[model samples]
Target: MYEGAVQDLIDELGRLPGVGPKSAQRIAFHLLQAEPADAQRLADAITRVKATVRFCARCFNVSEAEECRICRDPRRDGRVLCVVEEARDVVAIERTREYRGRYHVLGGAISPIDGIGPDDLHVRDLVRRLDDEPVDELIIATNPNVEGEATASYLSRLFAPLGVRITRLASGLPVGGDLDYADEVTLGRAFAGRRDVRG
Candidate 1:
């Protein structure tokens, strides 16, 4: 165990998600050994982000103003809405440069075990947005995990009567992954989403 200010630093670092006590201690020592200016810069960056950054009013993604840049961009298609579980997923999809539609961040997935439900997420906001916007398609881009699937299914049922085209992201084995090593769910999804190959 460390003493005084170092122990305080370790305690604070341990509070971060996925940072256990040992890892927190390791990071604390690493920061202490670094240059004072480097440590100060890291601290300042954290403070600045917390102070200036906020959720976008339109898409619920992290932003500095009322709306995210994607929401404000005129080039993005307003007819298609891509719904995601978190703000990070938005960034991941944006890097692909394939989609040109707006996004709606759900904040989190539905997990009854964790006491997280439809009300806990931004589902109501999504429903409200559907009524206000002229969106024709809703792409459910939740993770391919159990919680993500549940959330997607729940949303699909809720939007079924609305007549919006609902679609889920196709899941399967990774590009370089061997078919033999694939899990049942992934293999099943691949089979269900199979397409005809034209020669």
Candidate 2:
């Protein structure tokens, strides 16, 4: 084990999600070797994000203001809301360019193994928005994993009685992926979500 601030830096870096002890050590050493200005820039960016970035009051997306730009925009459809597990999911959907509706960030999916549940997420906040806003449709855009499916199912049941039309995003194999490489669940979903060709 290292002594003083060197060990302290490594320990701190290791605390970050997905960063292991070896990775944290490497990062700490890399930062130690980096030019002072570059390291200062990284530190400044972290500080700036912590100080300025906050969740939007309307949709819980990361924003500098009370509401995110998507929430503030007049051109977006207020009747439709895409619900996602995280802010990063919002960014991914935005990059697609096809969806013109607004979003609701759930913060995280329901994971029993991880001890997370509906109460742990921003579910109550979502219910509040549904009651307050004119959202007519809710697009369940959670990931297609087990946890995602569980979360989606829970949400589907919870919102079914709220009078909003709910929909789940179709999951399937990638465009160029080979059939042999596809897993059973993915292939089944592909078959389930297939549509007829309009010739």
Question: Tens-digit lDDT track for model 1 on 7-80?
Answer: 99999999999999999999999999999999999999999999999999989999998999999999999999
Q: List the residue pairs that clash in candidate 2.
A: none
Q: lDDT by residue for model 2 over 75-183, one digit each (tens)? A: 9999999999999999999998999999999999999999999999999999999999999999999999999999999999999999899999988998899998999
- The TM-score that candidate 1 achieves is 0.97
Clash tally for model 1: 0
TM-score attained by model 2:
0.95
Clashing pairs in 1: none
Model 2 lDDT, residue 127, Cα? 94
List candidate 1 stretches off by more than 4 Å.
none
State the lDDT at 102 in candidate 2. 97
Q: Which candidate comes out best when scored by TM-score?
A: 1
